[model samples]
Target: MSRQTFLEPFNAKAMSYAEVARTFVPSTKFTQLAGAWNSVLVGPRGGGKTTLFKMLSVEGQEAWTGAAAEPYKQTVAYTGVYVPSDIAWGTMLESLIEAGQDETVGILFSEAAFVTHVLLSVAIGIDRHVALNPVLRLEPGAETATDEPTQADLERVIATIARLWKVQPVSLSPASLVDALRERLLNIKRDTRLRAKLKLTDTPTQEYLGIDMLESASQALQAFDAAYRRPHHRWCLLLDEFEVAPMHLQKTVLAAMRASGAQKLLLKVALAPCGPDLLYDQQGSAPPSQNNDVQQVQLWYADKTEAIEFCQQVFLSRSSIYPALAGKMPSEVFGTSAYAVVDDSEDAAQIDLFTLTGRNKKQVTEQFQALAEKDPTFQEFLRRKQIDVSRELGMQPSDRHGNTLRKIAPLVAFRNAYKGKSVGKKRGVKPFNTAYSGWESIAAISEGNPRWLIGLITRIMSNNDQVQFPVPTPQQTAGVQWNCQRYAEMLQSVANEQFGSIKTSTPIYDVLSKIGDYFHNRLVTATFVEDPPMSFVVDERVSDDVEHALRIAVNHGAIVCYQIAADVGGFPTLRGLRFRLTYLLAPVFKLPMRKSKSVSLSTILEAKPETPTSQDDPTANPAGQLIQGDLWAN
Candidate 1:
């Protein structure tokens, strides 16, 4: 498969089965799974339950192509079953019986069922071959082949199996016929001709018992039943993706398999996150009866350390299900690296990107220094750009921006003037802000959701050197203006996607637009001010809505949120937060706004009384005013 498609199954990363089992710290649930019994994997999206399920149900399936086969291969001796919801119940049952006809082919049952005294376990759809089907295959006029299997083909196979194992072909009574058929089917051994045709493996762990080709359907079931009950050998059954199966069928199948006291038959089931809930929901409020007895296994996320280790392992182990980029750097460019540096100072002289090196340092120090040293003109230019945007956006002397900046001047001063450098200097490193500083913007935009932060960083890095604007030969004013406009449009689009639609009813659009305008203005203003406003707050009345929207935007990775103390009643209340408007809206849809802060009645009603006048009089008879007389009042 091509590299892009190769990693599709493993795209879930830490949430996948192998990673979760390996990296998740051991818990009671993990220990329970280690013991025998059925299991229900549970977790929210991205929690890694599915990954764990795959690890247990399909051994060696995820191994790298052409790798050495597993030692002590856990050949599936029983029938393991996977019941996809899309497949009809009858179709699923049929496939299991047909596949199980090969006495030597260990049947993995996707669902459960019972026979008289003999519990015939079946693993419904355990096809290692199907799982390994190539994702891409050739087609005429196709640029590349795709490997998606046809569901219709699978259903046919299932139907074939059901017909073969069916008993009393002409009868309407299913229970007795099914019972008789189950006995014959379980005892039957593989047909020699069928075994030879498939080039069946001869390993003791993998027996390929052939099925009778010439025998009619009824005759075959009868022969299989007689042979299956001999008890010389055991039949194993595996159930997979149980959550997707019909609840009634699942309960019936599981109940039957458990009832059969046969020693040789073993049952294994694969469950999804909601497996338990689905099962209980199907059963209703009544407590499970004495007849119901099945063990359960639960899968969940590994501990933080385990999760980190799993992530590292996923990056390191290139030959497993998800191979890494050969010779690529193991450490993430945007991860919390020791190379970053932070400083709190107003002196521009203190910042230098090139000479700085230390663990857990902020990038601001080195970035501010580098910009101030190598391209001081560019640094000054950005500051002026920010100031201009702020003024143009109407964030003026008494606006929210002005108020927030006045309160957090010290922090802005520190951020603006500070200089620091990364540790463990390496050659060919990009400038600090350009390289690692965007993560701060990402974090600022995403608020703290690692997923959103990663996505934003990934997008930014992907397009970092795309030459988005025209290069200036003479640096004319028109060219600069044109480039700036293009840049602004791009920034606006990103902001709109990330935070604009968070609330349709509120003024989020106005807020974000103002913020973006303020950001552009600050870049320009920072050049001249002792410390320009790097952050601002919305009106306190809308703080909750703003905060909630900001959080959603951040989680989806639209922007970063930081707590800032403002002068509330003169005690430096920490009531405000700040973000980069552009990053918050970078990943969602973009709709243009006709205007920000449209004029309305509320704006015009300055100092108006809460209640309206009771009545209106044209005159009180004093000039044009009507006078109230004592007689008229009586």
Candidate 2:
């Protein structure tokens, strides 16, 4: 397959079972997920939540390679059944509720349809495991692989589940039983759709109503265990797209997940970080507590080391398919680091002098002097460390082993290199001041999301099939900007529905665009602003409309937020929240891809908005005294 051919699987849901398993790359979180505990796999969209959930299934395990797969296969005590939620289908189920007589009956009908889909997946998963175990040897214990159940035993188990699920099979075989379950689901959908279409006011009902979803699932697993001769075999129910599931159903599933330990069932649900509904079913009722009842495994790539390593592994794995990229590392293709030192007289495109260390003595001495002379903040930083800016820089001083100055040299080089140069359009539109590139920058911009990383890498590699390793800085910058533009377009369209009702509704894109401009002014355009605001904290008294807008922005990945205050359920209360724009758009806004201290959101919104202008008193505020106290306050 070509490099482009391999890129399709980056959208993990679109790939087949075998394809996903074949191309799977395991990360540290995979080990955490493979355990028997009930875990909520939380991350932004395209952060590989679906991929990880799919890998837990039997097919994924069967096609998995390397030393990692063997240990996981040999010792795993549970069989994974992957149940992917379809939002469209869930929406249909929700519509069906309106056709019912009362709210209680409506929910009953909706839950029945949802569970029918779940049960069908469970049956299908068991069938695949049974048929493939003999050849794949994924089952625990060496003898268990060859100990295939007799046709009669399998048929009896199928019959028992069919009866428990209130479905009659056309035949006493696994495939036939699956067909019956599918038909059952189809019938319910057909009935609901018909009622909804005719606007039926009569009491609506489903044949499978009142069947406890958890009880049926538990009983079905027991029947399968008895038939397979493994009396205590565990089942890991890998539920993907938990946020798409109806609100009531999510609560029920979460409640069941909390109590699943004694039932020999392990539930691992994959969901987006933020959603409209709280996980709790009742307003005042306590929700399932994290750590004590459930394990919350976040895949946000907050740890730079882990995210960088995983990005490298994914690059290597995906690039192996193309002959030109076979032996290349990300550094070899995207450049060694995000920033490099060059001669003070040169531009970013002048790459012959580029060095990752940023310690070329002449360049460092010249760049340091230029920045210190123009901006007094840099000079003060130097004075505080008692470092002579005129001296030729070679290495970190013994006296300042862990000091930030030595580490910030490369950043200084970058800041000086593009001080006033227009590299590309600002935020992919207006004339921008600088470009973000390099292997480390790409990884940071991805924010540990595999989809974003893959998109950026593919954009870089797709245009040049025969492109050589160590791609030039200019080409990398172009590709990064292109990727940023793509995401910027999407961000513009988000939150349209949530803001549709308000006459003065602010499009999320406009809000972020305004904020991005503000950040650009503080970080790059201003003369001598120190410790610019890279993020912001919201006050608790935000209007409901604005809070809802913010929540929608968060769920859509335009804004990345972290909770500071927690309730009994360990969920954030959306109060005093700290957040930053999604770094994938860093190139668009001409901002650095680093997280820093926050300022107040209200201050930014209240301040007179202004486009960034680089011609201001270039060196007047040498001590950062001109910076607004409330605008950049920690």
Candidate 3:
């Protein structure tokens, strides 16, 4: 069958579960955001933040728990309102600016408009919850109860407004105050049209409007719930893209939500990992991360075990959706001879010879025949080498008979030809090679991101899916190279987008290029040393540009920067970062699949001034003692 027949039904490239809701496979990220808990969810763009938010919805959760539409098994009535931060913030800014006020007054007015919108959402949430209770709807006093409850709600909202601004003479008319508040907010927005635009700048000012929105939302939620009398009298308010709101808004909303003491109202917000820091209160003094106020969960894989199983489930989930993939292993559908090792399978041996030595089977066979014609002993060894006993484990001919080169023809040829510079145990250097391959390699290339892993597979499956559209044969080295390069570039594009907004000296493209170039030059001789490290240690002394670049790289997932204690020049006991390109990009650079030793900045280069330098200035030897490898200097 065509690969499309088996794979197309399972494509999850959108990385969303809006349509294929049934095919939504749950991960640890799902479990963390699934219930009534409030969180500052920190992860990359496609790290399933939006997906988790969707999965927390009544229908989305039911699809997971195998029940009727319910957000969770808890008694709370749930309402998931997806508020996209950038869009909402932009719209509010536009409306507020249209009416022309001072930039300061305009910003405060915009914030007020936004907070009002959020609180109204809470009222609407309870309204939706209340709509479900027929007994409460039909109650004799239910219609009459709305006026008193709404008036009380108006008093609290008005009080919050009164506290914020001293100017107020017009009657609020509590009977239709929500409508009045909406109109009042609209009027402020309309007033902005008479003025010029405004921009938020970094200047120390205390004109910040901090009347708590979450507390106001909570108050409304409680009042509406009581007035309508919901079955469980509980509600979950999901605030998505909460981090994009002003830092003050984020802090005040979360702080007030925690302080609201409204058990019936549950607030869950989705936030990016790197942003105007949300962990601290607005004053930056108290941290609400004390478990009582706000909880945190990062969406990332802790280890290969977690990454492998999660990716496997994702693959299986996609496959299960297709009728053609019902009983077949992913290898059968995806062309992964996962059980095939380059040194074990005959086909794999040929493929690996081409990959390792840049030789085709025909050239290897012709060379073998030419060698046999010249030497009888070599020919006899070749016969014995061809006798497969137990694949790679089986011994080849003894070294006595002119070193009968068999099994890996390419390896034997390399050893026989370059006898003096052989990369073997004889030179005290472990083999300069990596044995990792197949499905596990694919998993590692994902770098623990489910969206990336699924994307990699879906892209490969779509190979020739656009042109002739044929089922690709099992993993070929050249094919793997092409696919991995494409995937890495895809990741680079994502990194570009993530770091695009940073108006700073650290351009992401330059950062990635610098890191890639540094390691490419450094790792060439790493195999000659004993247990060489693959990672690079960048010191703070190199340049501020480098430090900022590294930070941006780590945040955007371009490279994994790990902090370590090391002797950094004069600061012998200083702590700094050690970095390696995420393993996903390993194939792109042809680096060892296994993690490597850390290369320190002290060796690579010292900061040489613009003036001429002496022989001791390290500029004379940029490679340093470790990289100078005189023994490998052919």
Greater-lDDT candidate between 1 and 3: 3
Worst 10 residues of 3 by lDDT: 565-574
Regions of model 2 farther than 4 Å from truth: 1-3, 6-9, 93-101, 133-148, 201-205, 279-285, 338-361, 372-388, 394-402, 410-435, 498-504, 525-530, 562-572, 611-634
lDDT of 3 by residue, 250-365 (tens): 65566655554346556677655444434453555554443566456666554445666787777786667655556555445443322122122223322332332224434444
What's the lDDT for all of these models? Answer: 0.31, 0.66, 0.47
How close is every model to the real structure, measured as TM-score? 0.33, 0.83, 0.63
| Model 1 misplaced regions, further than 4 Å | 1-35, 44-79, 87-302, 319-329, 332-634
Tens-digit per-residue lDDT, 255-344, candidate 2: 776678667678888866655355454656556667666777776654555777788888887778777778888777776552422111
For residues 378-408, could you state the per-residue lDDT of candidate 1 as single tens digits? 3464465453322222212344343322222
CA shift of 108, model 1, Å: 23
Ranking by lDDT: 2, 3, 1
